[model samples]
Target chain A: MTSTTLTPSFDEQYVATRKVATVGRVEISDVTKSYGANTVLRDVSLTIEPGQVVALIGPSGSGKSTLLRAINHLETVDRGSITVDGRYIGYERKGDTLHELREAEILRRRTQVGLVFQNFNLFPHLTAIENIIEAPVAHKRLTRDDARALAEGLLARVGLADKADHYPRQLSGGQQQRVAIARALALSPKVLLFDEPTSALDPELVGEVLDVIRGLARDGTTLVIVTHEIGFAREVADRIVFLDHGEIVEQGTPGQVLRNARHRRTRDFLAKVL
Target chain B: MSRIVAPRSETTAHAAGAATPATDADATTDDTTSASSATADAVAKSGPAGGRLDAGLRVVPVKHWGRWVLSAIVAFVILQFLWSLATNPQWQWDVFAEYFFAPSVINGLWLTLGLTVVAGVAGFVLGAVLAVFRLSKSPLLGAAAWWYIWFFRSVPLVVQILVWYNLGYLYPTLGLGTPFTTDFWIVEFPTTTLISAFAAAAIGLSLHQAAYSAEIIRAGILSVDQGQLEAAGALGLPRSIRFFRITLPQAARAIVPNAFNEIIGLVKGTSVVFIVALPELFYTVQVIYNRNQRVIPLLLVAVVWYALITTVLSIAQYYVERRYARGSVRELPPTPVQRARRWGAEQWNRLGDAHTAAAPPPPAQPEPVVTAAAAASDQYRTGGAA
Candidate 1:
């Protein structure tokens, strides 16, 4: 409430804004992951240029969400590397040795890559603005007033300025998801990932949440969205990657992929989903 | 109003059975007319009867003979006990009050309260550590906690104090020294000097209380959701922040009630220290009664003191529980002070309601001060703005 102005001071503390207008080039190379004998991801490789909005569309258990999590190193790849904006996440490579970074390094890198969960895991104990301001004050080196100012700006951006003091339970599922997105954006991460963000919401609530993501896409935030909303993906994403059975079956521009998917797995999956 | 009818409340069938004027043919005709008229209505409204059972079936009210008999029996027993207490000289009330505030007895009560505080604090601190150890990720640490609780909880507190008192026979001297050889690093104090009766009592009581407290704390920790821990991990908050901010606050709601139960028990349990000749309240009462040969009155004095302490502890536990129970409820239940105020406000409002109803409340009868508590729930908003 004290600092309502979105001054340059708050913007300067953001990692994304400080980057030289060139950020979030995510690289995934030869990535493989498994839980026990059941491999969840297999030899998945993709590249995203700065400000490119990519949509990963697939059925359950297809490793589409796993691929999104790998970009932030929330899940480590068994045999490959994921780098966002040319910096290795979770692991540091020195010549042939790829040693896992310490927890502090992982947390520091995590502050730069934001992940929004399907459940919208807003801390239940904190109010909406507190949730938004927590990471910025803790990790972004922003003062309390500046963090509050930045959080207010983010909340206003998400069309929730009036909900500053409301607890998470007091908000609807869609509203809570938007608050979660605001919280992720608080530190101004270079890359943003959304995992089935609308799947947990009711059909009526899905549009408001989708509108928030659409606004982010319009404003040119680097986004990797794993979603089942085909029309939304077609409208918002620059490129669409379709996966089935733990491998990327096809990928192209939205029209090219959505209209005429070449692979059988991609077509069959789209046939059911669409 | 009826041309041919029995009394208003009597069953039609009963009246018909008593009738000498109506023939079987007339009765059959009446039954046929009524049956066809409301056959569907009978099944729906009265389960195969067109009206209530009182209209067609014989019924009578039963007196509550059992209730009267039970009430009489309870009143008789209570009256007999009161009569004996009032008339008998053997149960000397005068003797009870004479030694109740005696200096020696007061000192014993003071010592008892001191022991309760010391043992309760030490027990809870050790118990908290053991609870954390029980839940530690390392299997060795968890097993060590489990074994300590198992051993201490199994042994009797009185026996433990006795063993500590006679420890000189076993250890002879207690000090920091290298094991298996006599390479003493510090001065060795004699066992008798180290563990006096008071020390033995405190140690035994604290150890016994600790084992029970550990389980209460462990259960509280386990009650917090696993999702909260995962959420903290994903947020990249360090382990310390996660525990202090996320886990322990939530666990406290579950832990407080059980902890108070242990503390209240410890206050009463301190009387057992007398086994090691540490003269707490129970031993003090015994010593005086044995001299004067007025056992019942001296015992009554101990009971009264213990009851008073129990009442204070119980009140403290209530407020502590309320404090921790915040945020779990929508509006915290009114505190005892607020409740009393609200009750007073409600009585005044009821007088206003009676005045408006144009009927003065009876001056002779007892006023309804003890109405249902929910009636006062709306007025509870006065003091909880903070």
Candidate 2:
């Protein structure tokens, strides 16, 4: 496979024209999210490029998933501004004035950015094909024939073409996660957010889910993954971000950070994992 | 022999040291041989001869002395009670037989069944409408639904029945047909009115049933997963389709069981129509007993019929509940042994499948078509914004 070299500054350019760009990257400005007295994220800011793969790695309860959820405005931030592509998601700006967007508008914007949960939250009532087709037909207003065609192609892409009629309960955990990925991809999202995609899988099944995600990276679908798989991060991620206590402690090229870290915390974390 | 005695001391010392080791070896060997022989002996003892003896003994029924005695006492007491009731000089089957097949009583039973059917259908429709309205985004509709439930629930069925029966007194003209009284548009309801005892009973029973049915419908709706709603929303499904397709189907599982109970309740509740002289079961029985003065016998006939109908309804309820319970358990159509077997098989199959199935392949082809469509739509929307 030929290596495609992506400029480190590609993300910045995407964010600069985000408001006007047809496909925009996400820009999170000094966003601090807190629930009452407990601050989950404090003065955290990061920019995700349109087609860059950034992996967020941290121990449990480090606010990695929370930050991802906040990107989609699933969890309202106490004090933060998040812009997806160019549209302000959590906080909306109107005529030089900024306000938090209403729930309906937030949900509408969330469709642009699809979230794949660790638990593979496919609607259990829907079959694998239906799960993939639902968002496109409902949100995109695609006709049944068009939606089915698209859904069939997606199921085939996920290597579950034959299992399109199977329910989530009937599929194994790995298959369910793949179907979920297809469902998320059905929206043709600009940025895909994964929250521990393989954490719930058994040791034997985790590889299948990880392989599907690795393929996503190869396909140049901009991804922000919160994962615990050190090997996958090192292998696929262009940049690895180490988070602690809701703050980015260190971040750099996977080799520089994962293999030869300068920070003590990074070293300690790597030492334990290695 | 003299040489053996002379070496005894040296031999004795060597033997003493080796004795413990020898004893250990002997003990192990003895245990193995004993266990082997014991097993052999047990196998022989429990072989064909013992098996025949056991089989023969099994054919002889073993008596449970305690259970037999207890059962006998219960039978004797039940017999005594039956004899006392049967032999009583005042006991009369004539009165029961007369009332059981009375024309009025049979007519009342028919009326009761008809009223229950009407009220059940009407109440269910009204309750469904009220539930949907209560969940509506419109404040006016929600308030209207709430008020309707509150009014019907708070008012007693008897009061509602009486009020409906006496509605003519409130509006003596009993307006009907059309509004204006002109050559082109003229309609009038006679002062005599059309609301009869049956109508009054239906109105009262349906209104009462509606209140309870509303609650049942609401509970059913709430029992559905929030994901179902979210899925519908994400699909951009129209509100009506979403409710009918996703919401209602999921809610049916919860609704059926409660609705069955309500139907049974409505059937029994029809007896309340006796207030307005509706010839329902209870009222018909009352009329018979009042004339003959065989109160107990006439009442017994009503009780027997009610019990029989209730039993039939209860059986129907069981079947309905079973039908809706499908797919709710881990193992569909689960029996205890079947569930255990399924669980074990699932575990075994999962282990096998995990070892055999390869890692899921990545998307081999670029999803350029979908991505292109999204980009086009985005551009179109952006141009529209411009």
Regions more than 4 Å wrong, model 2: A1-24, A88-94, A97-109, A137-140, A143-149, A260-274, B1-114, B121-154, B167-200, B217-251, B288-323, B334-386
Clashing residue pairs in candidate 2 (N, C-alpha, C atoms within 3 angstroms): A18-A86, A24-A85, A138-B235, A138-B236, A139-B235
CA lDDT, candidate 1, residue A70: 78
| Candidate 2: Cα lDDT at B55 | 14
Instruction: Please report how far candidate 2 places residue B386 from its true position, in Å.
Output: 91
The sequence of per-residue lDDT tens digits that candidate 2 reaches over residues B221-255 is 99888756654554334566667756776687889
State, as a TM-score between 0 and 1, how close model 1 is to the true structure: 0.73
lDDT of 1 by residue, A1-274 (tens): 2112322233213324422337888998888999889898889899988888899998899999888877777677788788887778787888888788898788777777888889887766677898887776666479989999989898887778999888787788988998999988887877889999999999988877877787676566788999999998887788999887788889999989999988888888888989
Instruction: List model 1 lDDT by residue over B47-163, tens digit each.
Output: 222345533445555689999999999999999999998889988989987989999889999999999998989998899899999999899999999999999989988899999
Residue B283, model 1, lDDT: 94
DockQ per candidate, 2 decimals: 0.21, 0.13
lDDT per residue as tens, model 2, A1-274: 0111221234344334323223548888888888778778887888877667789988777789889888876666777678887797656788888876665566667777778888886766567887787677766558878999999888777778898988787888988898889888888877888888999888888866776776666566788899888987887777888888888888898989998888898898888877
**CAPRI grade, predicted model 1:** incorrect
